[model samples]
Every structure is written in C-alpha cells, then in structure tokens.
Target: MKNYLRLLTHVLLISWCACNPCTRVESVDISAGVLLENGSVIYDGLEYPKSTWYEELADELVKRYGCPCIGRVCMWKCCGPGQTPFNGSCLDTGLAEVNPFNPPVYRGREPSNITAYGTFFYMHGHPCIDSYLVDTADVNEELFIQENGTLMEVAIGGTQWHLPTGYCVDMKYHNNSVAPRLVAAVCFPEENVSTDDSPLLYIAYAVGLLLSVPFLLATFLVYAMIPELRNLHGMCLMAYCAGLIVAFPFLAYLKLHVGRIGVAMTGCLVVAFIVYYAFQTSFFWLNVMCFDIWRTFSGYRGGSTNKRRDNKRFCLYAIYAWGVPAILTACTAGMQFSDNLPSHIVVPGFGSRRCWFVNWLSEFVYFFTPVLFLVVSNVIFFSVTAHRIRSIRQETAILKGAESSRSDKLKKDKQRYALYLKLFMVMGVNWTVELISFAVGGSNWYWIVVDISNIALGVVIFFIFVWKKKVRGLVQKRFRHMLGMPPVATDSRTGRWTTSSAPTEDTRISADETAIRLKDMH
Candidate 1:
C-alpha cells in the first residue's frame, strides 16, 4: 500500500505538471467587423463592458464614420501614468495617455496636419497605415476631440482618421479644411506575427528538417542491419529517429499552410494527431533512454533465470513511451471534437494561421509540462551516470594489478563519456534552447539556433553511433559480405574484421558488452 501510494504520488506530480491537452479552432468569422451589442462591439464573441476603451473607440468611430467603420476593425494603443508618450503604452488595455503606440498614419501628405504631438510622436515612433483621412475642420475647435467628455485627437487616413480615442476615432470635418472622406476606425487585436516570412529563416528551418531526415533514415537502416547495434538503446534511438521523420515534414506543412489549418476539420485533426503522437513518442523514447542509463549505473537488474524479464521490461517501455501520449492526445482531441471547451482556451491560429493550442493553461498542461519533466529526468540520469563512472574507475583501480587493465578501463570510460556528452548536446541543448526561447518570448536568433540544433540530432547520433572508426569498419565488411565480395581478413581469436589502426577485438568486444549491458538494464 505504501509503495502504491508513493507511485501514485509520482504519477500525479508528473501529470499535474506536464499534461498538455490538445486544441482546435473556434467557429467565428473574425474578418467581419465586430457586432455592436448594446453599447459595445462583441470581439471574438466576448461582450466588452459598455464603457471600456475598446467599446468607446469602436462606438465613437461608427457613430461618426457610419458604415465604413462598421465593417472594419482598428488597432488600439494606450498609456498609463509615468509612461513616456511615444515609448510606452498599455499592452493589455491598448489605451494611451498622450500619443498612440505606433500609429499607422502616414505624415508625408502635402497638406500635413503636422501638429506638435503628431510630428514629435512620428519622429520617435512611426507606425504608418497605408492611408489616413484627416478632419482639418476640428483643428480650430480644439487640438483634441471629445469622446464621452474625454479630450483626444481624431487623425484620419489619407483617403480620411486612421489614428484617435481609446486608439480608434470617428471623423467629422469641422473646418471644411479637408473633405469628410469616410474611413474605418474600429481597432481589432493584431494577428500573430510569423517570422516564416524571412527567406533565411525559412531556408534554415527547411534545410535543417531536410538534412535530418536522411541521417535519421540512415540510422534506422544501420540499426536494423547490424546485429551489434540491436540493443535496447539502439532500438529507442531508432524510434526517436522514426518520430523525427514524420514530425519534421508535418511541421513544415504546418508552417507553410498555417492559414489553411484551423477549426476541428477532419483533415486538420488527423494531421495534428499524427504530429503530436510522433513528437510525444520521441520525447518518451528519450526519457526511456535516460532511465535505462540511470538504472544501469544504479546497479538494478532482473534475474537471468526469469527469461521473459528483459522482454517484459522492453514491452513496458514500449507501452509507456507510446501509450501515455496516445491517451493524452486522444482525450484532448475528444474534448475538442465534442465542442465542449471553454472560450478562454483559444486554439492557436483559430482565426489566423497554424492550428495549435495557445492559451497558457493548455500550453502548460499539454506541451511544456511534459518537456520540463523530461529535462529534469535527463539531468538526473546524467548525474547518476557520471557518479557511477567515477566510482567504477576507483574500484577497478584498487582491484586490478595490471597497468593494461587500468588503461583498458580508462579507454572504455572515455569512449562512453564521449558518446554520452554528444547525447547530452543533442537532447539537452535543443531542449534548453526551447525553454530559453519560451522565456525570452521568441527572440529571432534563439529560434534560429533552436531550429538548427533540433535538426542536428539525427546527424549527431549517426556520427557517434554508426560512423565511428570501429563501427564504420564493421559495417563496410558486413556490406561487402552481403554483396558477395570476398571476406575481409579476420582476427583469428575474436573473428571480427580488424584494421591495423583499429582497437584489438578483445577491447572492442569489452566495450560492446559494456554498452549492451547498460541497455539491458533499461
């Protein structure tokens, strides 16, 4: 009962921190102007309070500009106390105290209403719209227009006011200084900006994915063909590589067709499921590998007399790695398919591009939480492996008399650590970059580095495991034999083909044994 309780606690902790549910888009036509309900325009189906900045801005603009503002949405900017006029604004409220944040009103018109505020504000921060209509008639009435008894400016687009109250404004020409050209002044929230526009960024990501596939494919082939590489560790690696093969292409499709993928359509849901399952399975495989290493170093083993124990262990790992993700993804999908999700839980690209979960709750529950748990587990595994290596070295030194034995042990240790270090770089660095990118809110260079690093995993694994001096030689000989070539001269004692510079068969066999032993412990 105590053991079961402990196990339950651990399971609950991991699930609480790492479970991320799936998502799908809401059904709404965002392009249609928000409906004026009561005194406020309903934005994304949420009714704003009657007197909020967004409502006031939209209402005022519609009242003055008529149908032009009725069908279009506007961008809002706002400022709080002590914040500089041009430099800062309320990101959440979109209300400004002085100048709007990055107004899109072009000032290059011949009849410039280049007021002190507009000119200075433009100099500091110039976010220009295609064109704006100006109401020069109100120039003499007051420098600022009045809305619900508040003082504000109503700048129009070239064609009429693209920039004003609560960051959006309605236009009426008081001076007859300019024609009362109608314009849209309703502010809607900005769509998410994608860096996929940059050619270099696109190429880097595409190339990374492209480069990864072949190497991973090669890894799968080599592992399947070589009996020496068919241990549990290699099997996990192959599974991870397989996941990447499916995942990268799907990711590319997502980025390229971001706009087309939204709402819980049959096609969208199917593709999303595959992508999620592959990614989660890969992550689980990584965790399994880490656990295997830790168990090996910690000296846990099943009895050899229990012939099915190793097979059972492998089956359990297979089930855990594949099953958990399947369940989580299925549950999330089922909830979404039933159309029973909270409105606050926004599906990413719901009204824009790319189908994904965006709300913080969903992100934490579905994606980041699992990633965080895996990262922590990997760290613990590395620490245990390091300690075990050190302890084994010390013990072997005390027990063995021959200098050659110590040398052989040291060589094996160095090789193992070298490979492990590569493993850490492949897994650890990519995840670290992911965490940092999230923390820093998508810095350009950070994401670029991450894309490149993630794609390099397969290449790193292939080089470390398949392209090694010994492994490469063995594979070449094996291929030659398969191709009906004369057998390479072999070492009489160990029977493995040997090159002059390659390590002796005995040393190689010992290293192979060590690797397989560690894998078996998984």
Candidate 2:
C-alpha cells in the first residue's frame, strides 16, 4: 500500500512539472531596433515610437547624433574624405582631395548661374579650414561656407563672419563626373594667428623657467640641511621652494614639448596637472608664511615655546596648505571628465583642448579667482602686521636703559619682516605681470622683459632668504658639525658671533639646544 502511494505522488509531481515549464531569458538581435528590457526601442540610436513632434525629434537627434534636423529629417554632419570631426567641426587631414578644375558650387543651384563660387582655397594652416574655398562673390553677401563646407545664410550685413574669418567647403563629384557638388560648409576664426607668441619668445620663456630650478633647489637644500633653519618659518620656506622647484621644471617641459606631445596625449595631461598642483601648493604655502608672520607679530601665544605645540600647529598649516589645493585639483579633474554637466556650466577642460584651462573664462574662474582671494588675504595680513610692527617699535623706543637690546630685537624683527616682504613681492609681482601679459593679448616687448625678470624669482628667493650673514654663519656651523669640527661660538647675551679659545668639547652645545636658541632668536 505504501509503494503504491509513493508512485502516485511521483506521477502527480511529473504532471505539475510538465504543466509549468521554466522560461529562459535570452538576448536576441533585433533588425528593426534595439529593444530594452523595459520595452523601449532605440531606433537608429534614438528613442523610437515615442514622439512624432519635429521639435522633439530634433532635440533627440541633436542629443544622440549631434546633428541638426532639417525638413523633418535628421541631417547628419558628415566629415569629408580625409577629414575627421574634432571639437564641433571637421578637421582636414593633409590628404584632402583637391581638384583645381572642379570648384565647390552651391547646393540646389546651377553651376553657370551660381552666385557663389570658389575664387581660391583659403589655406590658414589650421586643420578646420585648411584648403577651404574662399567666397569671392556671392549674390547674397550673407551666404558663407561653414567649417563642414555647408552653405549657411547669416543676417544681412552681419559682422559675425569677422569673428571666425576662415570658412571650409567640402566637394563631391556630381554623378561621379568631373562636375563638383558642394556638400557642407564650416567657419573657424583666425584669432590664433596673431595671438601666438613668437617661437623665440617661447624658447626664452622656457629657458627662464628652467634657469630658476637650480636656485630654488639650492634654497630648499639650505633649509633642509641646517638644523637651526628647521623651524616653522624655515619649513614653510622649504615647502614653498620645493613647490616652485617642482612647478618650474614641469612648466618649462610643457612649454618646450606640448606642441610635439599634443594636448590629447596622457603624458601631456599628467604633466599639466603636476604643474598646476605644484603652483597652487606654492601659492598656498606662501600664504601660510604670510599668515604665520602676521600671527607671530599679533602676540599669538600658540606654537611659541613647546616643541609639541609647534609641531601641532605646523600639522594644521600643512593640512590647510596641501588640503585646499588637493580639493581644488580634484574638482578640476572631476569637471574635466564629467559628461553629465550642462553645456553652459564651465569645466576645467584639461587635456581636451589643451593641457590647461580651455579658455580665459575657465582659467579665470578656476585658477585666478582662488589665487586672487589668497593674495588679497595676504595683503591684509601684511598690512595689519606692518601696523603692529610700527606700534611695537614706538613702544620699544621709550625704553632708555635697554635701548641697545631693544634696538637689536627690533632690527631682527625688521629683517624677518623684510624677508617675507621680498618673497611676497617676488611671487606677487610675477603673477601680476603674468595676468597683465595674458590680458594684453600680444607679445609686447615690455611685458617680455618683465617676464624674463619674473623668471629669476628663484634667484631672488635665494638671495632674500639664504644669502644673509646669519644664514651663512648657520651654514658654516652645520658643515662643521657634519665634519666633526669645532663649532663656532656666539655671545649668549647678544646672540652675536664671538671668538673662543676654549676647547671644542667644553664649548660644544647640543644640536637641539642650538636649534632651539636659533628658533628663539627668530
């Protein structure tokens, strides 16, 4: 009885399985259109069977194919033979088909009675309009050739053509015969013709930038090697110098090699990014110095005595100096790569057009704005600090018995302030000139001279910070200590150099103590 029941149960299960077979989902190639899982069809890369409105279709066509809709049909922007689409228009390859006997003619117009015909090809050396036919005579002066060789009509007597003077016209043979058929038109500007700096100027600029690297490196080395110069101020200077050291070489490299490498290359993008980040960090570090000096003079008690406290303060400075620029750079990178952003929104455009900001507007918005803010803040800080210094000098001048000591302290303060002032002038003036030169829009000799002078910023920094009597003494002491020689003695009270006849062992001070003393003196 149990066996009969088991067999009956198996038969019922088989019947149920036969009644409900599984359905497998498989990908099928559709000839008419691509079918989505949601039952939407993509016909010719556009949504199909959804909108019949011409306006809607036009928008879809523009979004999907970047082509215009004409007469209720999508008119694709086609590149001619030996031409490739770039940016928005066709870029001519050197191998463009040329037929002097058969010139471009207006579409839908007879060849003999055509008002517009090619007088000569305008060869501007630009890929977009190279070998494009120049319109000598047009019945309607408003009619001009576009960059893709299409005939376009503008407003009567409009000056828009002056903006991008060059125009392109692509030709096709009618019925495979010698008769030419004009297909498309393109218009591009000659703005870059006079804007390009002379090759000699570029070479000089690159050379100037390269020349500063060694001086900047030397400045960094001096700060890094000397234990006494490893304080917050010295460390800031070192960081600033290091930023310039990295930036200058890369900038020079870009100036020299960007043309050969091409803006689209990965290496060009990487180098451009490095240069941007380095310069930004340098600016931030310089701001840090200015703020630090101001804080010191404002009677701020933090980061003064304790080593731990100083380190903590420096960590905070590093975070601000490095972190802000990192965030900015990341934002730039994101914008450069993002496709979701609207056309109106400005993007960094790095590596797309060139290895820098795409246009002056983007450059000003992304780079110059932040730099300007920092510079303004620095100016305010310096102003306040200067006022404070004057007040302190007046107060100290009232002391008669300790006049010499007070004078010496005031002199030291002035010297320190002077160093920062010189540094500020070096960077500030250089950038100011750069902004002016960029705005001027041409290779003016006066600005070129200023640019050459700006290139010596590293040398200026070296002289201002490292070529001093005090620094020389510190360098000498550091070298002696490294060589295991007798260290120089200084008067403890006045902190001035002194000759000592004492034995090296008895007169020797710990490096830490010397560093601390140097820190206190500053």
Candidate 3:
C-alpha cells in the first residue's frame, strides 16, 4: 500500500511539474490601440480597410496611442462590461478581462524604467475608465496621476491584487473625452501582463471527459451485469457514471462550439441546464457514496446487519441526488425565461453562445452552493468514517489474540486502510480541490489540479473497481462460457478452479485430488 501511494504521489508530482507553466506569472505586453494614417486604419502594422463608423473610431483611437495592434483591445472594453463583443459590443474588451480578475490593460511601458502609460476613454455616458494592474513588488508606492485635469496621488494599497501575490490598481478617469486621458504609473515588472491559452485547458478538459466515457460505460456494465456487484455501493457507482455519461457529451459540445455566433438562445439554455443537472447529479451521487460507506462502517462497528437498510436508504438518496438537481436546474431555466433579468444574468456565456451560468450570484445561489453543501457534509461523514475504521482495526487486532505479533496485525490492517483511501479518492477528495478552485476564482494552481483530477475520474473508477483480480476472473469465466469451453478443474477444499488434464471421479476435482493422492501414498 505504501508503494502504491508513493507511485500515485510521484505521478501527481510529475503532472504538476508539467502543468507548472500554466501557473507561472507570465509577463507579456498586451496592447490594444487603433492607429490611423492617411485616412486609413493601421491594424497589425498595416493599413486596414475602412468600414463601420465604430471601426473608424477605433482606428482613430489607435492612432492617438500610436499602437498598430487593433487586436490588443481588451475584451471588456468592447463588451461594455458583463458582455462579449460578439453580443453587440466592441471587440476590444476580450483581452482586457481574459483572466478571472480582469487585470488592467496598459499601453507601452518604458523599457529603461519602471514607468508605463495607460489610456482610458469615457464615452456613451460611461462613468470612468478603470485599469487593474497586477502587483509585482512589496514596496509601498505612490503614483502621480491627472484625473480630469487635476493631479492626484493614487495610492497603491498592496503588493498583490486579487491573488495574494499580486496587486491591483484602480485608476478612475473623470468623464471627459475632449482631452486624451493618460494615466502614467510606475510598475516594477515594467509591464503588468498575463498570457493564457485557455483554449488548451478547455481542450485538455474535453479530452479527459471523452476518454472517461468508455471507461464509465464499462464500469456501468460491470456493475449491472455482475449480480454480486449489484449492491448499494455498485448502485452509487453506476449512478455516478450514468451522470457523467449524460454530462460529458454536452460539455464537449460546448467546448467545441464555445464562440460560435447566433446560437439559439433556447438551445444554449437547454444544453446548460442538461450539463448542470448531470454534473450535479454526479456530485451528489458521490456524496451518497460517502454517506453509504459511513453507514456501513458504523453499522459493522455496532454489530448490526442491515441488509434491508440499503434498499430503504437508496430510495432516499436517489430522491435527493437526482430530484434536487432537477428542481434547481428547472428553477434556473425558469429564471432565464423571466423578463426581469438581463439575458446574460440568466444564461452565462450567452454572448459567447456557450451555455453556462454567467451571473456569479445566480450560480452561487443555484449550483455551486448546493454542491458545496454536499461536499461539506461529505467531509464530516468522512471524518466519522475514518474514526470508525480506526476503532474497527484496533478491535480486530485485539480479537486476533496477543499471540499474534502487532506487526502482523498492522500488515493486515494495511489492506483495509488502502481500501478506505481509494474510496476517499474516488468519491469526494477531488471536489474539495474544486471548491478551492472556486475560492481562487479558477485562476490558480488549484484549478489545474481540479481539471486534471475531475477529468480522470472515470479512469480512476475503472482501475480501482473494474480492473481488479476478481473482476477479471468473472469476465474470463463469462467469456469462456460464451465460447463453449468446458469448466476448468476445481479444488473441492478451496472451491477454486484450476488447470488439470487427468480425469477422476469428479473431473473438476482431479487437479487437487491427484496431488492429494500422491502425497498420501508418499
């Protein structure tokens, strides 16, 4: 068991090292500007064809900043906050809010000094242009900036921003477009920049889900077909896999068509609803597994045999796991159709044409909160289960008699300990990392771990349960029967099948009896 744990740890460490680059504090100059020359727009360092008035306006703005990369416009700048450019907004804000915190987008920084310039435009009756700069150092700093033609000292609060290791700068620009609002600030890293190919992350997640489908299906079949495996534990495993089966396809479809324009609003809502319902069911079923294990262990410790308890317990579990998520998803869907809420508030990723829970409040209220409740309950249950397991182990050691060495008992205990650990890993621990990912706004190392662990859930379940020696034996026996093979010889004493060519009164017992007869004659 120690060796097994050590190997698992090594694999996790290697994966973390490989994914470390995603967590690095990347520094890159992300610029957004429109440059104009000779009545033509300069984009990508080349003249762009004139088109809409807004396009012309963007070109004019770029010319003022003397920047040629029109693609550098922040996404938030284009969407007018809480919307994407494709949803009837400017395209510039895409880069601005790429990260979870939506850090400030700044102009070119001085290569020789720690100073940089940021531009803010207030038009269409907007209040102010705000830029968030990431903190690079621990020094207390003051900034000299002109707000609405009035010079002021903008105080930088800390060395870090949304992330404890970073800092944020909130520069409020007075509503005035007549003069170019330029905020000159000093940044230690010279450029407060981040680059993320979230597409890669999305693709990795999609691949993991895809890979899991077959394994999950296999697990479902194994539990359904094998009568001995058809217990409360197997039922929970089947339900979990069944939920994943429903979820992965929709999720994969969204990833594939994430940014396609003109997706039907109803279709997006439906897909999102299905995805939420399925994934939530999967999560709750895990909670059920934890509860089931705890109950079984507690019962065993108390000398109770509750054979019928599972049948009654499962009915209640199914209602909670499946029915609760269905109700919540329906409520969310109904809320989306209401006239009171904005479209994005109801349907997350609405502008991007990807169905997701966009409003954080709505998501917290409907989805994440319920899942969190289940997770918290599971944690408490796991603690109690662990204590019960310990007690049971000690009791077993005492029953084994003082004549037995303590080391031997401990060795025997290892198998049960390993079983509990595997149960914890499969049922609940990964989601704890998911909760941490939520706390960190999905922009940290925890997100990476969550992504990897959740995606590999099917593979984990398959290896831990379906790929066991007994499971293999069952499959082999079934296969031999299907192929019309004769039953292998059996050992009557141990009730096990064995290979033997010789025939005896009971041909099946020849393999063992032949050896016994020879030993007796000797």
Which one wins on lDDT?
2
In model 2, the runs with Cα more than 4 Å from the true position are 1-192, 300-304, 398-411, 490-516, 519-522
User: What's each prediction's TM-score?
Assistant: 0.56, 0.64, 0.54
| Off by more than 4 A, model 3 | 1-198, 261-264, 301-309, 341-353, 359-361, 397-423, 442-446, 486-522
Displacement of residue 191 (Cα, Å) in model 1 is 5.9
Predicted structure 1: lDDT: 0.51
User: Per-residue CA lDDT of candidate 1, range 141-247, in tens?
Assistant: 11232222122333211111223322332222223344332222222112223342454565566667777778889978887787556655667777777887888
Model 3 poorest 10 in a row by lDDT: 513-522
lDDT of 3 by residue, 1-522 (tens): 897667556655755654322212221111243535544445445444332112111322211122222332211122233322232223322232322223333222212222122332211111112222221221322333222211222222212222111222322222233221222222222123344334666677788889888988998998787644565666777898899989988888776654442333677767777888999999888777777667756765322123356668778899988998888777766665544343224333332213565335546666778877887888787788778768767666675675343434344234434554575665566766666556656343446766777778788878877887656655555566568775344477986777544542221222432232110000
Write down the TM-score for model 2.
0.64
Between candidates 2 and 3, the lDDT winner: 2
lDDT for each of the candidates? 0.51, 0.60, 0.51
**Candidate 2 lDDT score relative to the true structure:** 0.60
